[model samples]
Target: MLLELIEYHWAEDIDEVLLLLGRLDVKTVPLAGGTYLLGLHDDSIESVVDLRDLDLAYISEDARGIHIGAMTTLQQMVDSPLLKELFAGLLARAAKNSSSSRLIRNSATIGGTIATGSASQADLLTALAVLDAEVVVRSGSKTQVDLKGGSYEHPGLALAGVVYKGKHERRIPSGEVQLSRRPAELIIEVVIPRPTLAVGTALMRVSRTPADVSLLHAAALIEIDAHTYRKVHLALGGSNMEPVRLYGVEQMLEGQPVMNPLNSQKLLTILQEGMATFRPPADIRASSSYRRVSGMGLAYRALEEAMNVASWQNVMSSERGS
Candidate 1:
């Protein structure tokens, strides 16, 4: 595909950007970091709406939880004190490990990354999915999309955007759910709710080299009460279009006693059995068989680390009481 001339509009605010995108005559796309769009030589894009001036880059915390603006870069996430302290630094670790290149990390916006809907961003997506992050989008009105929950529906009205939500009764098989967004809609922010219970998280990835894209990755979030699992979230990447939540594995772990050596083997057996049905897409990076096996191992390790963090927190709580 050869590069074609395209009109560039530097928008002063969100309303301007939205207005430009909502135009019916010409095809327009939002530009944040431009990392995702620059690679695409799509001739259909008639105009580019520059969003850098919209004042979307911000990270803040409140009673609701953490709020990260759309234009916030990966490096900002990595350096955030709030992210480093929250959920055992799971988000920070994911952001740091997302790309070995400091330049890429500095330029890659979280919103743009999620917008791409690419499976290659497994590490970050897995972490977000496990954390039940909500994507706030603006079309005409704001809609919050929950990553864990299935698609959002608005009867009679075209959906402006859709995002992940946690804990749905009906599960999508293989946890393959895409963040659906219309061209006219814009993602404004991501919200991660504050955990009510003691929470621990872990992230694991397998790549050929330190900087190489992960062949597979897993992220786990475990909430514990009285040494029993109160809640569990397990997400895997590289097997599907989006990060897959291992609901089967999560269900098995929830309400179960914290993993002990005696029962660890049994749990591992269950985990392996649950993962057997996973069929990762074969690509130049690895075979389907290898990804499947690696997914299982990575999920298990991530779960183990989460449990360890939970246990340590319990011990610290006890010590404080004494």
Candidate 2:
């Protein structure tokens, strides 16, 4: 893999990267771990501004939330106590399945993958979406990261970019539903957080197998009080542009009884309402109709699993006297 014609620049600071970015696209690109980006051998990438020397790979926690330096390796996150304690399922699961191997993870950068934006394997987005993660992109002397933790990056990491400090979902009994096929596959991560009394369900699944991209995905957070649902937040990925929030479905669930898996008929009905609103893109992976239908199914399953986790936690804590 000798990049015979390409020259490598080991940049140490922001200004150094920016200077390189100002240059028009030639055979140039930025490199951190050189995991994915390096795989593509473009004739234009004659010079790679290596960012490994920037010391961007580190994980720290404070009052705000976990601050993951863009350069942090996947193994670092997989082994992080902070990640283990906070976003237990997502970090551990996504790290293993998101890429091809541990060696890749060692070379992969959180910033790199995240900055790629709208990747077929939308792991970090789901993980952050579950926890209401924020993305920080820096340019010039100023920086703007989404405070609401919305998806979509500014595009172009080659210039001067950084994706940093996204939070994880907070777990409360009957709080949010997190659904994925294998806890160890490259499936989307979803979290549905409730406003209060109701349950939130985040549904994520791949239409094809482990090696394929997820055909359907969703995240819905609702509040339930006395079996009555309220303040629902329904968001879907893999359909529409970026991810879409289902306001119509949320409106329907406002006063309805929480459909916690057991009520298949009612759950299906709500899911139907959700499917009706979707106009998913058709591709070789799956047709629009299939993706729409499966998205509903994933939502149903995710809600059920979330409830089970809630129930399990309640029982465990009661027994432990915590």
Candidate 3:
């Protein structure tokens, strides 16, 4: 927490920021909003390269997907009209629920949120995972790391070169360089691909108070075609260091009818079974058993909500056609 010894450098561009960070004489960290860096008590950090002057704050959409700059704040995300309209406001709602304090939301940048690797931000992280977000990073070179259906180790790992990238950008296949050996990389932006088919998304969280961090949370995204599920994504977090996608449950629901009585019962049973076998970390806020039970219920409800939204979309389409 000692700030007296640390030096701050205002970086005008990405290359300058990289040069400052690559200094062998001092340990340096990039600063965006500085919300996360200010909380760290590490004495090894000798300098901070401020990126505010780099102009890395904007939100736009193209044929590929929605592009959010790394320096965009949580409040900005919540206030974005584009986000509110996309996927039924899944990203906007997640950003709004991330923190009850307006001050925190305004000061915390999206890049820092993902780079800090905090489990308490599960609600927002899970939503991003369910959307299959791709993180764009730059160091000596540029690469786009895929979250890969939320199966990647952690969002932060993308910065460490531990995650695999798609063929579009420079491909850095997983295991090419271990996390410990990777050079410092800066997150440039996050890209979320637009869904081609009718899609619904939902996010749910359990917390002691509105201001308190989540004890457990779930997020789901579903695409339907002709009353049948064409694709499904489900992610859970809050009890662990990283959010986890429920691949088993997603696979079971994909290609199935939107949820008949039999399908609902079967899905519930499978979710319960999966939750029972998986263990969450125990912490002072809640016990592992409590998190397990909450996760099971949260996941089911999130999936149900997403399915209902998809059904409503179908109904509206039919009404319009008539």
Candidate 4:
């Protein structure tokens, strides 16, 4: 129980929420799903401004991409048909991997996931990264924070802005999430742009058990031009402090041929060299060397999956055109 609990305010709108947040002391915070907030017994927290009453929950799209409200639950995103079609269900797949229990997923809000920086380990972060997702933050005005190197907190209430790619864009953006100081005051929105090319994306993870967090995981999105890879997006997590894009490896494979089975060995070598600097932790899950080796294997497999999917997509598109 919160021994320091002093007050609970249920805000009706963003304005009221913002006003309440502006008056907060160190002991105050905004509450959303309460999945993460209520579980904490920190003595420093004296009050919680409940945001449930505010109309912050939503799942919509614009010409750019899909926009998910701060209050939107992981279960909501997983059930979104638009999201499934936009990135070939990558978001839904990652959301499923975010939490195993249906009850927990039903209660966890997107804002909470991002504010707590849980995205670092959540498969959703890697999926969003590949889609070039960004966080929309609002205080008095809205500020679009790119996911790459994005970490900020509003002094009072803030809004989330998520900008996604449209169906005609090629380049995917990147972003990052971190633990914030005043998440209650910040409005959080996640935006992900749709890839415009014929691309295939896949997610692969390795863990001690199905319910355990990933120890070494990788995700890939590859755009194919005939048999050549025109564009590649690759990310790896759970093998380091935070998930990171394999920019060097991506560069090497951007224009390379992957349809040939013989290239597998060469591609694996390139991936290993690219991750040569990676130093995974030796823990109960696996040894450091095992994690490193397995991470590379996962990356390679993810790429192969993506390639197969892209090839299928290309063939289907051709059939439709003909």
Among these predictions, the greatest lDDT belongs to 1
Give the residue spans of candidate 4 off by over 4 A.
Answer: 24-26, 119-121, 141-175, 179-185, 225-227, 239-241, 257-262, 281-287
Clash pairs, model 2 backbone: 27-44, 27-45, 27-46, 57-71, 57-72, 131-168, 131-169, 197-224, 198-223, 198-224
Score candidate 4 by lDDT.
Answer: 0.73
lDDT of 1 at 312: 77
RMSD for all candidates, in order, please.
9.5, 12.3, 10.8, 10.1
lDDT of 2 by residue, 1-322 (tens): 4364457788887566655654655445567677666565555556767777776777776656566776777777788876654422445555554554678777776766654445425444454554455444333233445344333664433433444532222232111122311111111112222122123334455645664455556654444555555455555565222455566666776777654546778767876875586876676667878767676777667656654444444345456765
**Residue 294 in candidate 1, Cα distance off native in Å:** 1.7
TM-score of each: 0.85, 0.66, 0.84, 0.80
Residue pairs with clashing backbones, model 1: 145-163, 146-163, 146-164, 146-165, 147-164, 147-165, 148-165, 149-165
Better of 1 and 4 by lDDT: 1
Q: What is the lDDT of candidate 3?
A: 0.76
Candidate 1 has an lDDT of 0.77
| Cα-based lDDT for every prediction | 0.77, 0.54, 0.76, 0.73
Error of 4 at 155 (Å): 37
Q: What would the per-residue lDDT of candidate 1 be over residues 1-322, giving only the tens digit for each residue? A: 3166368899997877777777889888898887768888788878888888889999999998888998999999999998899899999999888778889888888888777765335378778888888777776434475343334573353444574322211222112324356567777888888874478899888888878778788899988888888989988875344677778888877898876543667768978877767877777777888878778778878888888888777667767878
> Model 3: which residue pairs collide?
none
Better of 2 and 4 by lDDT: 4
